[model samples]
Target chain A: DAGITQSPRYKITETGRQVTLMCHQTWSHSYMFWYRQDLGHGLRLIYYSAAADITDKGEVPDGYVVSRSKTENFPLTLESATRSQTSVYFCASGLDRGRSYEQYFGPGTRLTVT
Target chain B: EDKVVQSPLSLVVHEGDTVTLNCSYEVTNFRSLLWYKQEKKAPTFLFMLTSSGIEKKSGRLSSILDKKELFSILNITATQTGDSAIYLCAIGANNLFFGTGTRLTVIP
Candidate 1:
């Protein structure tokens, strides 16, 4: 009841459609991150926020956008979905950075673009 | 760019057996190495090794990092069916970089 949670655990959408996945944490971590997992690839960071209203692009942030309006929420949006965008999305939060304190991850949202 | 690589991409073992998973990395400003056990959902932290030669243990899981070799290994002894999950190795600098992960399945 007091961990990270993601909305719409599974989503199916068509190309060019806009969709947003929500992530919320109760711990109020200083850093929040979004990652995508694809077959044959592990997890790649999409976007990361250092604090409220501060966000930065990660390895694969081309088609994705993220914003942290508050320390507890970091939402990711797909401007226009594509088939290539289909993957599992994970939201993570860290007290600081790195794995020193172990970042907490959400259950993950499985998105499929048809 | 920092990178992490895991070996034996996947492994199958019987319960009560011992398994070793490997992770190697090339990171700038290295700080520590971490291991996580993922099963169906989010990955849970297993161990975080900050120094070489010293082993960290939690239950049946143990891990060691060798900074000079730029590698780490996770050992699960007396594995149980619940031990079936993806073991992810991450190298942390200022940020954390995760490897592809080793998927381990322990059968009865």
Candidate 2:
């Protein structure tokens, strides 16, 4: 069950160069998200994690950077990449988020920094 | 300030025609109200509304929620052409906020 998997599904870096978008999941979910789907700005949240090392900072977290240590990884880093950071990047997994749940996405990476 | 607003950002029906997608939120303490369906990769889960009016179907898609008019509506009755795509509205207090979607285009 690939359940959730994303990793360089597509990429074309440039600008400041430094991209890393990798998210893996196998059910062991406990909240983990990082979104970025531009064009009218639909999915923003840039980072989140509620387990493993714990992390937070969404709603377009600046340049972006995240790490969940493990519990089914959660990685998203753009360090310097720019060109508005291209777009189309989503990786989600949830089992709980306070009271909401229905998140389980991964089949997107399509970054194009130039 | 947490917010999630989705409206007629775009729409074009045809096929069986029957679409209504709208989501409004002001997040603070409220919880749960989600519906996603974005074709072309990622964005699936379709319904999840916390109480309010109690209506969540699956077959032809359905959803409902109106915590005192906070807003939430997604109903696709006979629409086809794979039901087009781009119809997302998310809101889960404490976190999760997404809107700016609603680009359904079901034509055949």
Alpha-carbon RMSD of each model: 1.3, 14.2
C-alpha displacement of A71 in model 2, angstroms? 34
Tell how far residue B14 is off in model 2, in angstroms.
5.4
- Regions of model 2 farther than 4 Å from truth: A1-12, A15-34, A38-44, A47-77, A80-110, B1-14, B17-30, B35-50, B54-62, B65-73, B77-83, B89-93, B97-105
Worst ten in a row by lDDT for model 1 chain A:
A95-104
lDDT of 1 by residue, A21-114 (tens): 9999998789888989887888888998899999998788999988888899999999999999999999999886544347889999999999
Superposition error at A97 for model 2 (Å): 15
Predicted structure 2: clash tally: 0
TM-score of chain B of 1: 0.97
* Listed models, DockQ each: 0.69, 0.30
Pairs with backbone N, CA or C atoms under 3 Å apart (clashes), candidate 1: none
TM-score of each: 0.96, 0.33
